[model samples]
Target: MLTFEIMLEVDENKSLEGNVELVPQLTLDCVIFGFHGSSLKVLLLKWKGTEYYSLPGGTVKQEESLDDAAIRVLKERTGLDKIFLRQFYTFGKVERYDRESIRKKLAHLVNPDLWYKRPISVGYYALVDFEEVFPNPDLLSESCGWWDLSDVPELLFDHNEILEKALHALRLELSFQPVGLNLLPEKFTMPDMMRMYEAILGKKIDPRNFQKKILKSGIVIKLDEVKKGVAHKSPFLYKFDANKYEEVLKEGGLFFI
Candidate 1:
């Protein structure tokens, strides 16, 4: 029942002096996923002048609702207001708190004392179009971009564990949800869709069986047109039947792979 409550766009340079109206000891960490061809990518922020990298995160403001804060932060980072965002977990292990690590990683940006207090972070994962996302770094980060999940380096804090938990949550929901619509283009072949599933699940799906199962779900509709200019047989393109997709999502158990 944990909801999204992150604040990635807050200007809180003086919060340590008790000036900013931020919710004490609460933060939001986002694990954004984007698909690029065959790879599942995660968005990360690189701290300036350091080898440290972390998920984009911020402290929640006292005035905004948790859901509102998450929506605003996601829109600020991805430049898309209607993308898929889900709060998967809340991480607050006592061992995960490391004040010195925070001070060391952000020495150049702000006074380390600013984040000395340990926070209970809410984790949210989002699915966005790889091409549509306009990655923007905040004041403390040097660059923001996608990293292939397999190649993700050692992250700051307990972020690696958070990322792993987020992925596990995503895979759990994949069979029952039309999450593909968020990661794929408007028009795509069944093969393209299957590949996306395979990428996330880390396995290849049987083509014939996948097609049959998906078609039976009634979430996608085959179009009259096929992919053009292919050397091999051009497969018919398909699109999500928005109404049917939403209906299936609402019903929940009806749709499965």
Candidate 2:
């Protein structure tokens, strides 16, 4: 288990500082969401010399856009490039900087005056192929890996809120986008698809009904191949038809399965 230590800075007024004084320094935090087996998880990095877990993030370079910075950060931390990443929301609360955990973790590197000032952060959310990504911790992080979304420990600053929002967005995307394809392999079985959907929706779907609905959707192309080495009869493997999937997305088709 990981434990985060909270440190508070005491000012002359002995009150937490406001964001008006700390808006100049900005950081970009990315919540990398992935699905493995029947579980949903997020990638988090452990900061060096700190016990806290944080989203894989970095500061924007002076010459770069926030998007580019996020990509760079993701590649550096997760060994993933050209992934499906998106900017979800910006978090700029005055109390964001006043958190005891943040103040303590950063106190040694910054002056007390600067530590108390609030810095606005732009939060980006990314959906990556988990098995394809090899997460690498950067210079600032001691380690990096996936943590089950439902089992995440205490996160630093306002990261908890950002992660929650990312999960909410993902659930909503399940209804609109062919998101399950991103999490699955190039070729997968019907049960594999059903498991991924059930993990995201957090419900027990009727297996037979699910198979019927998905087959009717006509977005899945059945291959002439069958999964090998099973005790029972082999199940046919299927892959998403990218063109048809896009058309369904454009038409806002419902994927009840």
Candidate 3:
């Protein structure tokens, strides 16, 4: 079994003039997902003068651990800290470097020498409360925004593949782990939670069945409060009891839809 390594070392002070046998570079990319109403959004940055969208990511520093590097990148790009981030996979495929088309796409930034030494990238996926993040584009990007996952446009590099893998991992996690607490608001209604699950699963879930199943799980705590701003009878607000849910998950008693 291949274990994921989060930390990497690179000498930043070393000159690029030397004909080094290997161009060692460690980079961290995060797929930050946010849930807004019925849409699943992802944070993306648009590079200045470029048509492609890229994930908010940065290279690891010589003195920083991979976890530290990921935190630094997230804060620098999106102003989010202490979110639920997990490293799931490392991508080292040889074809990841075959940049014939990518070079043409990013002609302004591509160099033949750099193209020869494709960097291996590690991906981390984080679920964050959308309202808590105050995102700002980095110096390299002209704009940054949360894009609806359903309408994701042409992304740069191998980000498309990376995002696909992240989504797959997220679905697997949902099956066995209670990971949606961070993606939703602190106080949400059953409909809100159902929409989030449907968005993640990319299908329509029967409303009545969804409510019955999730409610019986005992993971959600019904509050005395009711959702405001509704024309009809307000729905009861609920919050995930993370501690209890995790315990159920560990005991393999948590329900999966």
Q: State how far residue 225 of model 2 sits from its true place (Å).
A: 2.3
What is the C-alpha local distance difference test score of candidate 1?
A: 0.81
> Which TM-score value belongs to model 2?
0.83
Estimate, for each residue in 49-77, the C-alpha lDDT of model 1 and write its tens digit. 67789898776778877777778778878
* Count of backbone clashes, every candidate in sequence: 0, 0, 0
Clashing pairs in 3: none
Among these predictions, the greatest lDDT belongs to 1
Candidate 3 deviant stretches above 4 angstroms: 1-23, 109-112, 255-257
Residue 199, candidate 3: C-alpha displacement in angstroms: 0.7
lDDT of 3 by residue, 93-166 (tens): 77775567765665554343454665688899989899988878875566889999988997887888889899
Model 2: per-residue Cα lDDT at residue 244: 83
Each prediction's TM-score against the native? 0.87, 0.83, 0.86
Model 2 ranges off by over 4 Å: 1-23, 105-113, 229-233, 255-257
Ten consecutive residues with minimal summed lDDT in candidate 2? 14-23
Q: Rank the candidates by lDDT, best first.
A: 1, 3, 2
User: What is each predicted model's overall lDDT from 0 to 1?
Assistant: 0.81, 0.76, 0.77
